[model samples]
Target: MLPTVRHLLSQPDLDLRLLTPATTLPERALEQSVEWVHSSDLSDPTPFLSPGQVLLTTGTQFDTEAHGDELYTAYVARLRQRGIAALGFGTEVIRDGTPDGLVDACLADGLPLFEVPYRTPFIAVVRSAADMVAEERYARHTWALSAQRAISLAALRPDGLSATLSELSHQLHHWVALFDASGTLDRVFPRDAFAGAGLPGTSFETVQREAGRLLGRGQRASATVLAGGETLTLQTLGRRDQLRGVLALGGVRELDAASQDVVTSVIALAGLALEQNHALAGARGHLRAGLLHALLGGSRDLAETISTEMWGPLPSAPVQLVVTDAPAGRLDAIIEFLELRVEEQPDRLFFATQNDRVVLILDRTGRLLLEDLCRTFGLHAGLSDQTDYRDLPRALAQAEQACERSKEGEAGVVEFDDISRQGVLAFLARTDAREVGRATLLPLINHDELNGSELLKTVQVWLQHNGAFDAAGRVLGVHRHTVRSRIELAETLLGRDLGTFHARADVWAALLATASVPG
Candidate 1:
């Protein structure tokens, strides 16, 4: 490490002594390693001074009578403002000694002040600091090279990005995270360390906003955030103003140039990985679409052969067709997420996008993955019954219809069977169903409108109660006799027998169909 004030004071040959009280000097200040030394004969040296430097002055300009106490105090304050590690005063040049105003100013500001005897030359101090700085730089170079090698080897592992991040986290002894362009957390080293570090509640929103802005510009940007009593640095991952993602590093430490080089290399690798994945996804999407076309055209044998070569043997019996929809803004993210899932488990599914919807031919058991994805992405999805590859066209139609129905109902997922409607009569097209519903209820609707009778309410309540007059009456806040009379009137007006289960079922379907229609 570079030499600090304490290190210089401890060198017996240097003959340096602390003029500031030991109690007054903080441990952080004493441990600060000086990067260099600056010797100035001028009074105002703030412009020349930099951080992590020990300022050396011979007190030749310390004329209390000429400069006044206030001017000396101002000079000392300026040195502190420039962030000098410490101030060294050389005695014997001034007629008196170190000015009391300078000493008082250093003490007030907690700036470490030490005295240099005339016997010691400032050049000696400069030499000691330079050697230490060079040694530290070399050490950092060695460590960075080793870390880069380790990270590179880890990236070659089968696990790829996860393994690379793990190795980096281990080497730095800090948490590392990667986020995709959509601002989703793609991976985090040490598992749940990000949450443990209190980052989610502290700076997650800011990070997401900045990440989105940087990604749009395809540029590199960074922000420093404080969380869990430690600093985190969030940086964009890109090259030449093309951003693919963002990276987060917590418990940040000052990195040397060599270490920063390793970071740049890692960022490059990550960007390349993302680009390759995107290209592969596009190619796979085309293949999946082609496969669907073959199956829909009744070329089952060709489809199966291609499927076997790419994603293992096709299910001989039947597979489920799933359709998914998301908002236009989130459509790309949802598609990318599905593509990743397909790549990770190729045999489980194959998917392609059609317009605003994603269609998938997946094993029956893959429903859970779709359900979870729907919830995660706030998507609406529809699933069809298992159908043979030969019947994929029909199955796809069913799934598309279900997906649209789910979206209309604002449901997360809708399975073909969940609607409990079989064959063509289950539910017709929107206009047809509305017309049929209006016809079915027209007689009773007109009667109630003309006579202001409670027949429609009574029939609906009776249907809910399964034709039980007493239960229906209780729900309607009326007596069983009144409910019975209302139901009879409804039956007369509709010219149907409400006593039969099939008849009531028909009326129930019509009621649901008209529930969403205006009178």
Candidate 2:
């Protein structure tokens, strides 16, 4: 703390005495902090003085005969306006004692006034105040060093991140909060800090919104805001491009240089802790991916054992698998959210990311949670039908196909059951099925290309006409006999009898599957 007027007067070496009645001084005026002690004798010393400084002067500027009471009163007013912490009048220089007019003016204006004995030189007072300021500065520096060391030790704890935050709050005497990369409040020091402080709810909300804006920019940043009569400082942790989280301090309107050093140390430690956690989370993610691979490869027992040992049980059989193509930027947030859910309901939800897409396996009752995830991230997801663990590979395929189909629909999530209800054509609209259809008709395609015959078209018309030769001929603008001959040629080339219903159905299905392929 800076030296106060009361502290200065209490010093015996300075030999200062209160000129104005002590009781008349404004509330806490005697305790006003003295930044520096400056001696000036100018009639108007306000120009040379700053706020919170002790202004010392000889009585030379005051002339009772020439300026009278008005001069002294105005001088006191000017000093007050300059925010002078206290006024000191050196006696027996140009005048024998402190002027009565000046004392009366100070009393009236509520400015603390003291008399500096002639025995005490102005330089002595200046030196005394300077030494006090220096001592306070040194004390604060020591505190900062000690605080940083404590915070560093806290960072070595098992719960290092949280321990560091708690230590920071203790050192700063302010509440501290940690926000995850997704701008969600992950932890707060002193659980009742905000509530016990009685801060307005909107204040916390404003801080949260500001945290979100900072994380949303995905850059290193800091922000200061005033809410509910308190000051808050927020700093983003980690690198500019890969922000790990945000650290916020409440009740800190500003930080002194020394305090800033302490806070900087805490930020560095917290950032390192978060970086370590991020690396560990990445490793766990890779493990999850490997586990998912094992599940798909039909090693259900091994996958389950590993998963149970690491993160509790996997979702039971008769689970619905969901696959989504969410954007890269939002994938981290999605995974983080799912991880929290998995922690809470380990046996009901599990997720992993592979090939730039997220795969989720949740119990059948988790449809609402899946929907919420899709809606929250604006994701297009394909959900597989409830299936046992043994059929995971088939389920994964179904989910992938449905996910592709979801892109063509308006909904954010589409289930395999919904796709199944569409018809056989919907199921056939896949890469493998399309390739098979193309190969099935390749013989006819090659025969038509080389001979310039209308065999393919004739077969298509005849199929559309439901095997009616007359109807097919009319549509093709050819005689019924010519249409029959073309159909015969198509059958020969296809090596399938068009006379049987099963063969006809197979040919029609192939034709539908390859409908979009260029000839």
Count steric clashes of candidate 2: 0
Residue-wise lDDT of candidate 2 within 1-519, one digit each (tens)?
677889888888988899877788888898888899998889998888899999999977677798789998899899999999998999888888888888899999999988988899999999988988899899998998899899889988988998999998898888899888878777898877656432456567778888999998888999988886778889999998799889988874466678788888888888998898889989999999999999888898898899999989998879989999967766667887898888888999888999899999989788998888888878889999999988888999989988997886665888898878866764675445777877888888888899898777788779878999999989889999999988888888889999999888777767767863221
lDDT of 2: 0.85
lDDT of 1 by residue, 375-405 (tens): 8888888898898877888888788888877
What TM-score quantifies how close candidate 2 is to the native fold?
0.70
Give the runs in model 2 whose Cα sits over 4 Å from its true position: 4-32, 44-51, 67-83, 91-97, 100-111, 117-135, 192-201, 212-219, 368-380, 401-414, 418-519
Clashing residue pairs in candidate 1 (N, C-alpha, C atoms within 3 angstroms): none
Error of 2 at 154 (Å): 1.4
* lDDT agreement with native, every candidate: 0.76, 0.85
Please give the TM-score that candidate 1 achieves against the real structure.
Answer: 0.79
> Which pairs of residues clash in candidate 2, taking residues 3 or more apart in a chain or in different chains?
none
